[model samples]
Target: MKKSISITLCAALLALSGCSQNTSSDALSSDISSAASESQSTASQEESSGSSLQNGNGGFKVEGTKLLDANGKEFIMRGINHAHTWYLDEDTTAIKAIAETGSNVVRVVCSDGEQWTKDTENMLETVINLCIDNEMIAVVEVHDATGKDDKTALDKATDYWIEMKNALIGKEQYVILNIANEWTGGWNGELWRDGYTESIPKLREAGIKNTILVDAAGWGQYAKSIGDYGKEVFDSDPDKNTMFAVHMYGTAGKNSSVIEKNLKYAIDNGLCVIVGEFGYTHTDGDVDEAFIMKYCQENGIGYIGWSWKGNSGGVEYLDIANSWDGSVLSADWGENLVNGENGIKQTSVKCSVFTKE
Candidate 1:
């Protein structure tokens, strides 16, 4: 989840220039724009696959806004987002250390050879095995698409999943595939809708069946998109095995009222949602992390704090642990997220998928 500040000069120029004269050239341009818009709408509809409850790998399925295990038990994701892609050296023990915090799930960041070193099939297998051994649900994500505008990177992420099909096919009980960390930088509901509706089914097509999780727009903070277009996205999934993620930061996670409103909106609207990434503080703005934890704990909504260790570039405070070995915890962010009231230790419940019961 990255946000690069940008200002489009053309938008400002258009505002200053006002409406252009409707000359013959302008009329022709208007016609072209209308046609392009219509064409895109039609293409989105065509590309969107119909809904199904196929249960390809027969592991977890979404049943009326709840994540159900193969045994039909509810699995709330009380977890943490581990930055494995950024901190490759910690790959060996991150899952176990996070599991020791009493978390039932772990969202691991990954790349598809696009931006960072590719997490090879062997690496993925290691990560998945580690989660299984530690009795945690592994939600692997592609980070290369973070804050991207085009679908090329998203498509590449899809292809990467297909390449690792052999490792993923039978692990549906323990794994969930997060399509992309934050696939688009802009808030184009149509683009986000069309992108997932078209690309997600490819996994089922390749026989890699796992519950899918898609992040919201605006670098995973624009939760309004979920309120606006969530139903359409849910209906687009062939398996109906999908969940939505919202990363609360300065924009959408600023206050207690705002946090409660966004969480209520998604749950009230009958869409399964999780707080994929959040922190007590950020350069973007202060996050009401206390309210976030309390709200999720009370509502039975899944929540995972920003990270375990290894954060930098002016946001080093996000690192929950002071060291890579997970010995020391940070003063504010780490302590609040993991051990404070309404924190993971107090609220986390292990998924039935792992327990023998």
Candidate 2:
């Protein structure tokens, strides 16, 4: 069994911003305990409101803060992000290799002809089928809007999803439509909320019903944006089938306290969230990857490490597997995330839908 941390020690480890040095440990503990209780109460209320798989349109659904697969079984995404748009040729074999690590999901990056070559409808179908063949869920995301605060880019991405309806309309049971990766560049919570609130309906109106995943603003590190307006954005979805995601790099993953506080706030708000992307370390600073994996595991949250391979721009170290076929894994990030305690290999369970007769 995975080791657990006490609430008190967990609170104590929080940064000074969270727990003042002048504050007594007892007071800190009391505050954290209250928050935890409130979170549980809120989750219970959400579940009681009929937010279960029965309400879903035959696809993934969010119940309270848990994700239920098409089979109505709880599913936690333990997987890696594969940059398919950049390394299209490697995906065929790379996805199979990723499945070998016991992962149950793969966040496949694609472009909408805005920033990179548009992944044609045929290519999209091929990639999603590859993941399904490997017994993993496909999280299809458009990379064109990364770090763009402009609403036009986000709209274009939405348009791309609509154009690919032929490939996504019937794959709701096996695919997640991540609207656009890091759609906003700044930490403007209001803008972030408005952009998604506007774009989500467009996708729904276009006949897309897959569970939508929206990344946090500020290049996906601004968890504060999600904590502040995640509910409003989620409510914008007419289907109420949207979930939030946060990319944890140095800015958001520098310490245990920051990570806990960000993720806890989202969970406490009764929002379905996942660590959509995270690296062991980044140019901004070092990341507490160990805590991220441990906390997600114990809390029944989901995480997808960034990435499978083919990282560039001086961030090549972020690649988890060195060889495309996964014949050799990186010594630090790859080894630990895939094979270490609380890692994918130790915790992932294939979605029950694949096993059902």
Tell me each candidate's TM-score: 0.84, 0.85
Prediction 2 TM-score vs. true:
0.85
Worst 10 residues of 2 by lDDT: 1-10
lDDT of 2 by residue, 1-357 (tens): 000101001211223222001212333345878879877866775675433345366788876688887766788999998888888899898999999989999999888998678899999999999999999999999887877779999999999999998898878889999988887767788999998899899899989989999988777777888789998998999988888887777777779998998887678888889999888887666789999999999998899998888777567788799999898999989999999999999999999878844
Candidate 2 Cα outliers beyond 4 Å, as residue runs? 1-55
State the weakest 10-residue window (summed lDDT) of model 1: 12-21
For model 1, the superposed segments whose C-alpha errors exceed 4 Å read 2-56
**Residue pairs whose backbone atoms clash in candidate 1:** none
> Candidate 2's C-alpha lDDT?
0.82
Per-model RMSD to reference:
13.9, 11.3
